[model samples]
Target: MKIVIISPLWERTPPRKYGGTERIVYALTEGLVKEGHDVTLFATGDSVTSAKLMSVYPRSLYTDGVSWSNAYWPSINISKAIEYSRKIKADIIHSHSQYYGYVFSPLSPIPMLHTHHGTLKSQSIGKEKQATLDYFKKANYISISRSQREPMPYLNWVGNVYNGIDVDSFYFNARKGQYLLWMGRFTPKKGSKEAIIIANKTKRKLILAGKIEKNNRNDYNFYKKEIKPLIDNKNICYVGEVSQGKKVQLYKNALCLLNTIKWDEPFGLIPMEANACGTPVISFAEGALNETIKNGHNGFLIKPNNLNGMIKSLKDIDKIDRLTCRKWVEDKFSVSRMVTDYIKVYQKFVKK
Candidate 1:
């Protein structure tokens, strides 16, 4: 089968770090290629992939430091990718762009399978977009989690494929380490402040690692005001953003991962990534965390925003077998399973 994947232009496929969505794209594309499908990936030129690559931009837009300021970049990226898909005579066009492909699905020559990778309740998704999605009910749409389908369930729901990671890459360690881990962009919704409070209350050494996007006002101010002051370097350490290799090391060594997310995240890859490394995760019971973190099996899930509950759960974190955590991800959230599930979704539309 000839397939064309429309990936996000913000980062390279299989990003060096900090790209959960792009990682999925790269893995899915590789998996499809391994299965012997003729695949073409539309991503930035720098993205390394086994499949044939096509791109409108020479490099990722984020590296330009002006992608946020300019709206024309992505507009042209997606536009040209779709135009090229028809030229290639692709059998299936798989889109990872949130809702930009919704408009094109109406008249697409090839059967377009759109994967909704974000929460549907954002400011960008206005009434007009919602109405447009509702109108295009025949278009096949895939959700990352079942909870993500809450806002717009009327669309032609094809499948719910959870975010997955390459388990073999994340080396496992049965023995827990000294410091607790919190890795994510510093934001109010991500709960860095809450994680600090838990670390302080529990009297455990905490390591905070993730990028602080200085260009974004909300993230920058939140880091300086709320998160930075708390980083004393003695009890709490802020080890900027880590590369993928270092991230795996941190996951393997940390006593446990803290995912104190305040928002109803459609699906979080951090917890599953940690679990793949034989590390337990203590997360708030928000959105898909309830499904991602298996209670008493891989990690514990407390009530949302309940710092006290999270702190208390930390005490029982030892009860969780690290091997069980690894197995949970291997059985349910491995990249192989994700690719197979996606192939099933594609087969529903593509004829043999």
Candidate 2:
């Protein structure tokens, strides 16, 4: 089948540093290509892919430091993608551009598949919510997790496909390291402040790795006020956004990945990446963490924001086998499995 993947313009596909949706798009694009399907990736010019590449912008808007509002570039990128889709007569257009697909789906002759990479509440609100209420039924939607669809069950959903990773990209380490790991944006909702508290209470070394956008005041203020002051080089180390190599090393060596999220995250990608590296996760049970992390098996899922439970789980982390964590990801969250599931979805729309 011929497929065109529409990606967000903020980051390159399989992003250089921090882009979960782009990474997924790249993985799925490559996975489909490897399966002998014709795949075209509609992303920034900076994006590298095994499939045919199409782009409107010379580089990613965020990486290039474009000062325009977030909505502006995506609108242009989506228009370019739609124009390309019509020219190619694509069998299916799988969109990762969030809401842009809903607006353009009516214009395309081919069937479109939209994957909701973020939470419904995060995407839909006020005018956008009303817009979604009016037009969401026209496009086929796929949820990243079952919990993500609970809020808007009335929408036309094809199925829930959990985000998957290329397991081979990660190095599995059976022997764990001394420090705890916290990876995500430095935001209050991600519970970075709470991770610091848990690490301090448990007397464990903590390594925090994530991007703090300089332009975003909320990210900068939170990092300065809640995160920077607490960082001591010896115990609490704050490593800024990591590359793929550094990320693998951090995941493979950490004692356990800490995900003390306050929000119902659509789907946390860090935990799955950690699992692929044979590392266990001790995450708060919110969003997809409950579905991803098996309690007392690969890792423990504590109640959200429960510092005591997270601290306690650190002691019992050794009981969870590192190999089991690797095995779980290989079975459930591999790129091959994700591609197969997506092909089933594509078949539903494509006339064979």
Candidate 3:
């Protein structure tokens, strides 16, 4: 099958730092290529992948500090991705971006697949409801989680294929370090501040690793006022955006990964990635965490915002074995499985 993957313009495919969608695009593109399929990645020039690269931007709009104004549509790269898809005569175009695919899908030369990544709010849907309905009527939608699909219950949902990672790349020596881990954006929705509170109450060393979206001023202020003031403790370390190598190392060395999300996350990838590295995730039982992590099995999923429950679970992290943790990921969240699921979706539409 000739597949063209349209990556999000906010970050490069296989992002250098933090980008769930970009990372998933990279995994899918590589997984398909490894399966002997013709895969083309329509992403920024900075993306590095085995698939044929069809760059729409000179560099990543996020990494290069380029605004939407810098591009032809001011900062959007959707036009370039759509143009590339048409040029390649893609048998199927799989889009990892959000509403941008709506504009291209209506006139697509072939079947198109759009995977909704973010937790869409009512306001966001209201802004693009007509366009989204029109696009989904002609194209297939892949929801990252079942919970996400409920918002637009009327859309043609092809299936739910959870985002996965290359487990081998995340292999880290679990005994290298002794500290709790928090890896995700510094936004309030992610509950980074709550992670800090739990770490403080537990008297455990907390290593915070993630990027702060400078554009969200309120989030920045919350970090500065709430999270930063507590950073005075020697046990708390705020390591900025981590590289691929650092990410694996952080997950491997840590005793466990902490995810205290407040919202219904579409699909949280950090927990799965941490599990791959032989680290159990101690997360709140909100959103996909409940579906991904089994309480007292691979990891612990406690009540949302329960700092005491989180601290208690963090203490029991030793019960989870490295081999069992790795096995859990293989059984449920391998990139191969993700690829096969998507291939099935593509076959359904393309064969028709």
List candidate 1 stretches off by more than 4 Å: 67-70, 122-132, 135-138
Residue lDDT tens for model 1, 85-104: 78988888999976677777
Clashing pairs in 3: 68-74, 68-75, 69-74
What ranking emerges by TM-score with the best candidate at the front?
Answer: 2, 1, 3
Better of 1 and 3 by lDDT: 1
Q: Ranking by lDDT, best first?
A: 1, 2, 3
1-352 in candidate 3: lDDT tens per residue? 8888888766878888998888999999999999999998878888999999977576677666655334343124556655666786768888876666765667666787889887755654565555566555546788888877666777778878988778888884546357888988888878888888888788889999999776567877878887888776478889888998998888988888888888877889999998888888888887677778888888998888788888887667888777688888988898999999999888887778
Pick the winner on TM-score between candidates 2 and 3: 2
lDDT string, candidate 2, 1-352, tens digits: 8888999888888799998999999999999999999998889988999999888887878877775356777878777777887888889889898776788777777788889887666343456655664666657889989998887888889978888999999999999888999999988888888988988888889999999877678788989988999999788998889999999999999999998898888888899999999899999999888888889988999988788998888899999999999999999998898999999989987755
Evaluate model 3: give its lDDT. 0.80
Residue 178 miss distance in model 2 (angstroms): 1.0
Give the better candidate number (2 or 3) by lDDT. Answer: 2
Error of 2 at 42 (Å): 0.7
